[model samples]
Target: MKSSTIRTFTTVHTWTGLLAGFALFIAFYAGAITMFHDPIDTWALPKQELADARVMDKAGAMMADIVAKHPAARESIGVTYAAGHPSHEVAAYWMEKNGTWMTQAIDDAGAHDAEDHEHGLADFVYELHYDLGIPEIGIYLMGIVSVIYGVALLTGVLIHLPNLVRELFALRPGHNLKRLWQDAHNVIGILSLPFHIIFAVTGALLCLTLVALMAFNVAIFDGKLMSAFERMTSALPDTAAMTAAGPGADAKTNVPMLPPAELGAIARKAALGAGATNFDPDYMRYVHYGQPGAAAEVRGTSEKTLGEYGMVALDASTGRIINMQLTGARDANHATYSAIFGLHFGTFGSLSLRWLYFILGLAGAFLFYSGNLLYIETRRKRRNAEQPMKVRAMATATVGVCIGTCLAISVTFIANHLAPYFGAEPTLVVQPVCFITFFAAVAWTFWRRPAKAAVDLLWATAVASVLVGVLDMALHGDRLVRTLAEGRYDVLGVDLVAMAMGVGFGWLAVATRRRAVEGDPCSVWAARSPRVTATTTPAHDG
Candidate 1:
């Protein structure tokens, strides 16, 4: 690329990254934790004493009773049969009137109280990743962010192309702070380029689905988009077929739906026959229940496959298999699509792959953070007694949003452990607590010097992370011990990871404080002092 072209691409990269970096940071960090979604879910919920066999045996009866009591559930109900380790009890889920999902756990006696369930810890984290916890609009906004992120990635590569290979592993943490940050940013960005690209594309696809559907409906499909999508994705079987016995047969008016146990068996058999061997159904939906036209679709995951989740539909009246969509048996188009989804979510491969994804996710978060730092550093007016207002503003926002988001997430975990003691709903308070802490951190950043604010936030995050593990121990020590005794490490893993994060954050705080006091005084990250001057270091060139 020519020098002028490089400058233009550099400008593009800077603005696009600045615009989308903060949100992407949150998404990446939260997404890192979400890779262990099931473990976090286990950590949040009360200990499950019932064995998987016990839960599975009674699940059918419990679900039948649940549907009998709450007919609304007949429309759609999710049954969680098993989760990786420290297994959750068999549970039934349905959406309440206010749109809150209600879950009822089937106990040892094959009974449950509808009001007893609470949301999982990882749910909020997952929500923050894709939607930032804001409803309808948040997802759309993130979709736009993803598009910008993709453009930024492209421009970033174009700008770095000349030195891409020569400086691939370059890192000089020396007097030139801007160079250090630039090198770090470029290194991580290049190393994780493929992962970032996958995230950008998959995120856009997932979040932009609604908008794309609407656009295609009017622009290309001529109102036939729904049918086209169904054909492409191989959606559930048609409900109309449930009423017809065969071609030219009279439609049945009403018929009772099959019990959960029977439907589960049929779906399981069909899914296995369709090439999904370890098919464990986690979600199901019913249409026209207790009528002749009733049908059920069971969605599940299979082990040792790139296509993790698949579905099977069955006739609810006779427990007969209607249709199957196993990822393992999917065609080239569907398989490729499903593979992208699986890779983005880190659902394929073994535990090792998941760990790799987790590390890369946190690295991606740091890439954005370092990009912000580099932006501020490059723009700093080092000669002045104070940095430019915009540089200061950017610094404050970056510190407040990035560190604050980590602090807020830690607070949510603390809330998760503490909520039950006060008879408070964790789900209701998690988001509020997170937002409050986040905004308070931002406000604090405005009040304090940028360097001081960054250090303070780091320390606060460290403390909160440690406290989360401490509170979990205090609240659920017995359960943790019991799980360990049973050779299940779900809850134990979360607690250990929390403490490890605390240690890591605490180390960062100490390092950051030292750097502020002793490192390049001309840099924005250094504490302001009379000795600092622009002439101390040469101006950074893009």
Candidate 2:
């Protein structure tokens, strides 16, 4: 393409990134915490703290109880396993039509009266970051934004090609107008380029590929694709079919199967034989329970993701193993499918990989935000005031989405704690409230002053999110103290992260406020030139 063509694309890249930047930041920020979903869940629940806790028996008794009450759970659903004591299992969830269903969390031990799900808060934060709080639509839109983001990255590289070397690591903090922003934008983007690339590739693929995949199913895979997928999924055998109470059949013959602990033990043995260790099977299911063909299965995970080797499904009746996919053996087609999901979800590796991704994802968000500033900066002098009013309106929109993201995230942490006391759904309350409050902030900022809006929102995010970190320590200091007392490393994981973010965001908030009060060194907020009235000779006078 010609240089001009590339330039036009550069503009597209710049605008898209800027407009999408703030949301991207929230996504990255929250997503980094989500990497510790299990740990967070641990921090939230802390089951191990129970003085009477015994991990093994808990699994069996819980499963037996859940299953006996919800017997129809046999054929329809898979299982979920945990790696705890007393019982390592919940019966896989079984839903009948719409929302009506029986849970498989327990068997013979008798079932509880609750639904089979957990973790309201963490899951909500995750969804917000990825989907922007909308389900299907939000994810898809973010994907589109990601693709355009790639374009912006390419464009940025080209524009700065000549000066990149000299200004590459430059962070000239003082009075130079262009130099300051130029340095801030450039250094951050370059330092985090790899992160940007990974997120863009993964994010776009996750968001935008569904339709393309559907097309692949149509154009490439024969109509048999769906069936192929289903068959490839493991089967459940320990579940029972509906009894007709035929002429000779005993309707009362049904007895719930073995204790969950025994079945879990069998599962662990099988998984070990299959070359998978740390078989913390916490969920169980019987596909055809009591009918002589019933099969039970267990599924769970290891500490970090790499050793997970995925899940294994086995033959329940004989404790005879049918198929397994724990390690590298996890069949190719299935592996590709799984890998895409893994890479997108940021769950493919060891500690280092996850952290690497966490930092990069945040950088990617910054890239988008910077692209926006570059866009407005490039054009302000030309349009000045005389530019069409709609052009001015667009600037307002970009600022809203970007700053709005920071504001919402800052609120999410506060909302998490507050929502619980109000007897509200923490996730629902935290998310929507964050957004609504953020939108209000943006509108006020825009009407009041766009530049000021940027500065204030940043500060707001810094305070709210940072304070959340501080408060977490303050509220949970006892627990953290216990963690230290017990010499458990994971406890420090939560503590250090919270305190670090608290300190960092506090600093950022102060910085932005100072910048606004002192006047930013850059003409960062310079307005477009005023429009000129066309002069004409008065007909009579002339």
Candidate 3:
């Protein structure tokens, strides 16, 4: 690449990264934690005792009773039979009139009246990644950010193409701060290029689905986008017919509904017959439950395949198989689509792959953080007495948003640990607490110098991260020991990861403080101080 072309590409890379880096940082960091979503849920609700097999065996009766009592459940209901988390086992869910999901768990006595407490820790963190916990507009905003991120990735590759191979392994730690940051950024970016590309494409697809549908309807599909979507996702159960059937239709028509246990067994057999050897049904949905036309769809994970979740649809009334969309049985196009989702969500492989994705996600977060630092460093005034106001502002915002996001996430862990003592709805309280902590950190950055703010916020995040792990250990030390002995590592894994994050953040805080004192004096990251310049009078007087 020519110098001029490289500069233009560099400009494109810098601006796009600056525009999207903050949101991407939050997404990547939260996403890293969410890769272990089930474990985090287990960590938050550690005291849940596992229900016996009898609970699952009687799931059909329990679900029927639940629908009988809550007529709205007849519109659509889902049963979870074998969730790894105890709280999630044998749970039933239905959509309310207000479009909210209501859930109930089957107790040890095989009743459906067990209270469903919110599992906010993992869920809230997951929400923060894609939507920043904002309901309506957050997703669209993140969609746009993902588009910009894709652009940044392309332009970055263009700018670095010439020296990419030569400098692939270069990491020069020297007096020049910008060079050090640039080198670090390039190495991580190059190594994780494929991962970054996958995230960009999948993220845009996930977040912009509705927007793209609307656009296609208006532009390309001639108002047939919904029809096209229906065709594309035909494997999923059709809930509209079930909803239109209304409650008690089967009872009025003298049709018998199959019990939940029978439906589950049929679905399992159908899934296996369809070639999913490792299928374990997590969710089952019934349509027209009790009528002769009643159908059941069981969706579950299939291990050792890229298609993580597959569906087996069966006739609930006669135990006849209707259709199977198992992992190995999917059509080429549908299988590719399923593989994309599985890869993006880190559900395609075993523990080793999950850890790889987790580490890469955190490294992706670092890539954005270092990009921001490089931006600040590149724009610093070398000969001027003080840094530009814009550079200083960018520095402050980057420190506030990035570090604050980490702090808020750590605080949420603490909030989850203390939820019982707080005696309130943990979901409602934890979200607000995160928002307050994030905005307060931003506000504090404005009050203090950029360097001091960075150091302080990083330290705070370190403390909170370590504190969450310590608190968890204190609360569930015996349980952790027992689970470890029994080879149940979910909660223990989460705690260990949290403590590792604390150590990582602590090291970053120390390094950032050291840089502020010892790095280039003219840089925005350095603490502002008056430079003393001594002048000697000429010898012209002699």
Model 2 Cα lDDT, one tens digit per residue, 1-542:
57887678667656666656666766776777777665555554332333122433554455444445555544344444445432233444676545575544443353445564533556766777678777559888888777777777777777777677887778876654345666788888877776677677878877776666667678889765654555454433112232232232242344455654567677778777766646666566665554444456565555444334355555444566655656556767556656666766666677787777767666665555555555555554332224344435555665677667666755766676566568875535765776688678768767855656665666676667556656666766777778679776564676467656656656865665564455422233423222333342211110
- Model 3, CA-based lDDT: 0.80
Of candidate 3, the 10-residue stretch with the lowest lDDT total is 533-542
Q: Residue 187 lDDT in model 3?
A: 98
lDDT of 3 by residue, 1-542 (tens): 67898889888999999999999999999999889988887788777777656777777777777777766677568887765566566778887667777788776765545444354678889999889888889999998998999999999888888889988999988777688889999999999999999999888888998998899899987897776675465454454554344454454453556766677667777778666777777788776655546677778777768878887777666777767777767876568778778878888888888899999999999999999889877777665547688888888899899999999989988987787887865666778889999999999999997888999999999999999889999988987898899889988888888898999999999998997776655566666644722342212110
Question: What overall lDDT, based on C-alpha atoms, would model 1 receive against the true structure?
Answer: 0.79
For model 1, how does the per-residue alpha-carbon lDDT over 1-542 read when each residue is reduced to its tens digit? 67899889999999999999999999999999998998897787764453456666776666567667776666567676554445355677887566767778775676667663544568889999998878769999999999999999999989888888987999987767788898999999999999999999999988998899999899988898876676566545544554454344232333566655556667877777766667776666666555555677777777657878787777777777766778656766568778878978988788888899999989999999999998887887766546788888898899999999999999889987787789987667787888899999999988887788989999999999988788888878898788799888878888888989999999999989998887656556776655645465423321
Between candidates 2 and 3, which one is better according to lDDT?
3
Would you estimate the TM-scores of all the predictions?
0.89, 0.76, 0.90
RMSD of 1: 3.6
List pairs with backbone clashes in candidate 3.
60-260, 257-290
What CA RMSD would you report for each candidate?
A: 3.6, 6.9, 4.6
lDDT: the better of candidates 1 and 2: 1
TM-score quality measure for candidate 2? 0.76
